[model samples]
Structure formats: C-alpha cells, structure tokens
Target: MASHQNLNFQGQIPGEFLIARIMQIHASISKLESLRPSKQVNILFSHLVKLCILPSSIDIKALPQEVQQMRQSLIILCARAESLLELEFATYLSKISLPLNDLNRFPYYENYVKLAKLEYGALIENTGVAQLKKVAFVGSGPMPLTSIILASQHMKSTHFDNIDIDETANNLARRIVSSDDEIEKRMKFLTSDIMEVKEKLGEYDCIILAALVGNEEEKAKILGHIRKYMKEGGVLLVRSAKGARAFLYPVVEEHELFDFKVLSIFHPTNDVINSVVLLRKSLIYT
Candidate 1:
C-alpha cells in the first residue's frame, strides 16, 4: 500500500505542480492571515510538515534536475511556513527530524557539506583572514551543523563558540556537537542572546549568522551590538538573501552593514534560498 502511494505521489508531483502547490499555500496563508495561524491551520501545517515538507532526496534522486528542485522547493515552503507561524503554532512541527527507517538523507547533504567547506575556505582565502582560529556562530539552533562543519575543518588550536537564546536549543546543539569527537574538542555552546553577548571572547576572525534569525529589527540590533565589539577587518560569514526568502530568513543586506565591507558571496538552492556572505568589519565615518 505504501509503495503504491509513493508511486502515485511521484506521478502527480511534477516540477510545475509542486511549485504551484507551494505558491498556493503561501497565497492561502496571506489571504487568511488571521485564520491561518489558528488551531485549524496548525493541523494543516502539521500535514504539510509530515507529508509535503520533507525533501524527496531518495525518491527524486534519479529524476530530472528540475523535478529534484521541485522536491527541495516543497521543503522550502514548509520551512517558511514554520518560521512565519511559529508564534501561533510553535509545535506544529519539530526540529529537522531524520527520516523514518533511515529514509532519505538531508536533501542536499553533499551540497551543504561542500558549501560549508566553501564558507570556511572563503574565510581562509579572503585577504583579512589567515586562519579562522577563533570562530563564533550566532543563532545556532538544535542541530548546529554549520558549527560542526566549520569547526571540524580546522586544527585543535582553533576554537568554536556557538550561542543561542533558547536554552533548549543550546543544550541540544552542545549534545549533538559532543557526539562527534572531531568537532566536540573545539566546539562550545553559550546560552545567551546575540544582543546580550558583551563578552570579549577576544578577536574572532570569523562570526557566522544563521539564516533563521528573527526579523530585521532584531537583526539590526544584533549587528549593532556585534559591531561595537568586533575588531576592524574581522570577517562576518553571514547568510545573505535570495528573492522572497527575505520573508523568512531576512538576508543581511550590504546596506545594513554600513560599517562593514562586503567581501564575497555564495548562493545555493535548497530548503531556504541561502547565500553565504563574507564581510569585513570596517571603519565607517558618516
């Protein structure tokens, strides 16, 4: 029965149809904003998280590239929905759950690893950064994959610090990092909000900002606080924007960092249209 249903899904869920479905849900939420975040809509989002939001990595692995993109597009839609409706229905879907029975791995597992390498490489290859000896990751949620990847790449002398406002998330990230021996030796977690982070952890060559950080106002405040403490030429490896993802993962526009110079940028198409931005803290006289 399950096999038959999976086949049926593939038959109907073409690239265009999948894209349309996502747009349709987005439209519905926009039109029914008041009702969309209520209890009734929570059920709808739950179903989307369960049945539709997942990445069809295995199912569409051999399919056309376009179809594979559609599979990821669905994941993006669910992520956006969760971000928007979290206040009203925080528990509608849990953290990035592993697929049942060792199902499909992360949609872009290799791509993500590769991009993480590039983000690290950019930090090292850029002018100001010789070695990313001290790294800090902000807004690291339960699974601090970026921290793991970035931290793992460097030697033991390098240290990585990750902080999140959510205590639960901080604990989870710490546990996950501890499980991996390579990353565990260097990674540390702090349960503190980015805005309140006044500690002079010395000079961090690189600081990464997760895309899932809250709205623009909060982001500006965080940036402002960090700027006050960061050293000149200190690099910020931030997540930049792509099209409408600004609605959820508000991209740190270059304009926002009037005191920082844009170094380089990388874009990858996945759950969230993500851009790895490399920035250098600069002296701004305005």
Candidate 2:
C-alpha cells in the first residue's frame, strides 16, 4: 500500500505534483468503492502507501522498470531526504573526508557517496575542497543537497541563495528551511531575480551557478549582469548540461564585463548528468 502524504521539499518537485498525487489517490479510492467491503479497505490502504512511500524508498530501485517510470517525476523525493541526512550528522562526519555513514541516511546520496569514496569525491582528491569557501548556490533543486554536502566538507559557509524567477523553482525554494546549525545563519535564501539579489549579496568569494539559465543567450546575459557583483579575483563555478564550451568559448570573444576563464572542468563521477565548469571571474579594473 502507498501513502499519499506530502513529501519533503528538495531539488525540483513542486506542490502541483503533490496535488496531482492526491487526485490520483482519490481516483484510486473511487475505483475501489464498488469492491467488497474488506477488499475495498485493503485496496484503499494499499493504494495509499503505494502513492506515498514507493516514491521515496530505495526499494523503488529494485522494482520493475514500469514501476520506476510511474514515480520518475517524483525523483526529487530522494534528493531532499539525502540533504537532511547530511545536515543531521555533519558533526560526527566532519573528521572524515567523505562521510558515507551520514550520506547513506538518504537514498539519493548513494551514487554521490560512492564516487566521493572511490574517486576523490569530485574535488581532485581534496584540492578543490581546500580551495572552496563561502559557497553561494545560484540554483536550487537536487543540486542543493550535493552543494550542501560539498560545503559541509570544504567551505566555511554554504548559501542556497538563488534569484528565482521560475515559479516552480521558487515554490520548491520557499519550502526549503534550514535547520542545520549555523546553516541557516550562513544561508541567504531569497526569492528575488538574480540581478536584484546581487545588490544585497555583497561579493561572495566563491559563487556557484548550477544551470542557472536555459540557453547560451540567457547564460551570457546573466553572466554579464553577475560581473558587477562578483569580488575581485574570485572564482565563479558554473555547472551546465550544455558543457563548458557554451560559456568559455563565447566569454573570450565578448569580454564585456568580467573576464571569464575556465578554471576547472570535471563531471560528477556518480549518477548526476551535468558536468561541472569552474570559471574564474577577473575583477574589472576601473
């Protein structure tokens, strides 16, 4: 039996998805109304738990392909759970380089944790970890968990701060509340558009933009706008599905704001699909 309870906010799932599940649950219950009394009750409980728990469990992986597809849209369920696990046990795992015990608390962390344990945890075996500080996330979704995990390991502070213009992401961001100790103190969760947030964000030493825009034009526009806010000699790390070439090649030909140079290019060794591009933003000389 599946449960229809509202899941935690993580990555990209929105309230609409929850509403849809409720509708589906209602329809399923209606279907069982004509059945025998005992059968109807059993079916009701079964559907309830199936609707709720199946989407969140690791056992969903072992289920048939058809079963997985039904819940694919709700993938963010696992991501948010992982974020909580990492935050909950940061103190105990602070000494270890990659905290498997903590990460395994949630299901989505499996791939990332495996990569961290076996393949230097996506930071060149700790070099990138040493360099990270005051990390500011430009996008929120499943990536926040990964970002928070990285920040917990390396950065002095982590900010899941995005200038959300997208309604869906804004909804998810609104649901995210930080309870991870000073995480709330370090976090600047805001809902304004990017340019607007820049005014109050000051200049973060390390700014991370994870697929902040849709295409090259939007990316370029945001980058141009972002230059005004980035500190001198600071690093602006960007992750994109289109790859580093999308930003790096164009940045050279059009040096309007800050100079863009590709500092690092590496893909996450785990299950995530996007590649990481670390670009250094040269301070503008007046």
Candidate 3:
C-alpha cells in the first residue's frame, strides 16, 4: 500500500513527492491479478482518485522525461481500472429489475451526472442549439450513463447514437437502458469503431469523444477523421484532463485540434476528473 504521509498538503514540492507516491501506486496496481472490482483494488483506486485532486504546485508538463513516461503508464493503467469497474457495475445492474432507475447505485454515478450537465450546458451555449437532432458518442462503454443522463435529463427530444468498438459493451449498454422507453427510443447502440464510421459521421449534429477512447496518437487520428468526415459546423466535445488530473487521463492538446474552431475549454478545479473541450468543425477546411 502507498503511504499518504507525504500528501499532507504542506510546503513540500509536488513533483518530488508526487513521483514517489505515483510509483508506489503504480506498483500496487500492477500487482493486482485483474483490474476487476475487488475490495483491495477499489481501495487503491479510491486513494489514487484522491491523490489526483490534491493541490499540486508543479504542472504535469513540467515533470522530468522519465517521470513523465512513468506517469503516462500510470494513466493508461488507471484508465483500464476505471473501464473494468464500469463494466463490472454495468454487468451487475443489467441483471436487476430496474437498472436505469438504480444507476445511482454505482460509486461514480454522480460524476457522470455532473459531467453530463457540464457538457449539455457547453453544447447549448456554443452551438446555440436548444435541442440537437442527432448526437453520436464515440467510445461509450457498457455503462453509458453520460448519454443516458444527457438524453433523459437535458435533451429529451434529441436522438443519441452510442458507438463503441466492443459489441458486448454495446449490448450491455442497450440492456441497461431497455427499461426506459423514452431513453431507449432516443438511444441507439452501434457496434463499430469510430474510425470506420466515416461515411455516417456527417449525420450527427454533435459527436462526443469519451475520455478513455484512445491514447494521444489514436485520439489525434480520431480527431483528424472527425475533422474530415463530420459535417461543417457540427460540434465535437472531446473529454480531456488538466493539472494533476492529467496523471489519471490522457490530455488533449489544442494543437492537435487545429482544424476546428475551439469555442470553450473548461478545466474543472473540483472532483470532476475529466475536462471538456468544445470544438466546432470549421466551415472552410484548409
């Protein structure tokens, strides 16, 4: 187990102590038999989440080369652990009688709710669209609570297409929302990689790239694909991370999104782990 003594939020330099703490957490997570939801793993991840939100004096980009590399590895490991937890909880809920209504039972359910509210507000303000016609969420996993919450709570009249590379995830997402007729009618789960859906990309009024979708290079590729195929003026919301939270998730750089016009980039200084970048496809592509 990693020691939390150094994280006393004192005058200690963040980069120095953070590296040691990160290595400890990395070693602990690596020893886990699987990233599945277990008592030990959950405890470790909970600590990691708290560590990420701690006040840090040094920026992630200022870390040394080797430390940065290790941090990237830790980020990937954390993403996997998060995905497994979502899958495990989604699978569990799918077997229950009323899964959609009971979604708040999941530990991170409120996080998704907060994220949905943030993204919905950004879409409305940036796009000036009171109700979107069709929206596509790329990399929506087994428990697509974001899409469900957005559809049910924010945009009741909008249609959402939940796209994922894993068919099983898509099936599980379908089952999780099957009980809600309104959301079920508005939500469509499609099993296809976002890269392969170039032909149909233009149909969406908005496309959201989930935070755990890919690594830096993969996200760049997906962004390039969206820039080329998505309709002009369509909004694209890419989930990102800033400050210490970048250690938990891959950060999206503005340079990678040169083709689009950035409308808003919000970095929450709170418990919300994922920052959001709102971009509009340029009407005149260079």
Residue 130 lDDT (model 1): 48
> Cα deviation in Å at residue 86, candidate 3?
1.5
Q: Which stretches of candidate 3 lie over 4 Å from their true place?
A: 1-13, 284-286
Backbone clashes in model 1, listed as residue pairs: none
Best by lDDT: 3
At residue 216, candidate 1 shows an lDDT of 48
Residue 12 lDDT in model 3?
38
Which prediction has the highest TM-score against the true structure?
3
Put down candidate 2 lDDT per residue, 175-226, tens digits, no spaces: 3324354544555555556766665444565666644342434667777666
Q: Which residue runs of candidate 1 sit more than 4 Å off their true CA positions?
A: 1-22, 27-108, 128-130, 154-157, 244-248, 268-272, 284-286
- Candidate 2: regions farther than 4 A off: 1-108, 111-133, 141-143, 156-162, 166-177, 242-258, 267-270, 283-286
lDDT string for model 3 (1-286, tens) is: 6446444566533667766777788788888888888898888888888777766665777788987888788888888888898888889988988898789989999989999999999998887887999999999999998999998899899999999999999999999999888789999999998888987999999999999888976889889988899998898999998777888898899889888889999998678889999998986643
Clashing pairs in 3: none
**Model 1 TM-score?**
0.63
Model 1 residue 224 CA deviation (Å) reads 1.4
TM-score between model 3 and native = 0.94
| Candidate 3 root-mean-square deviation in Å | 2.0
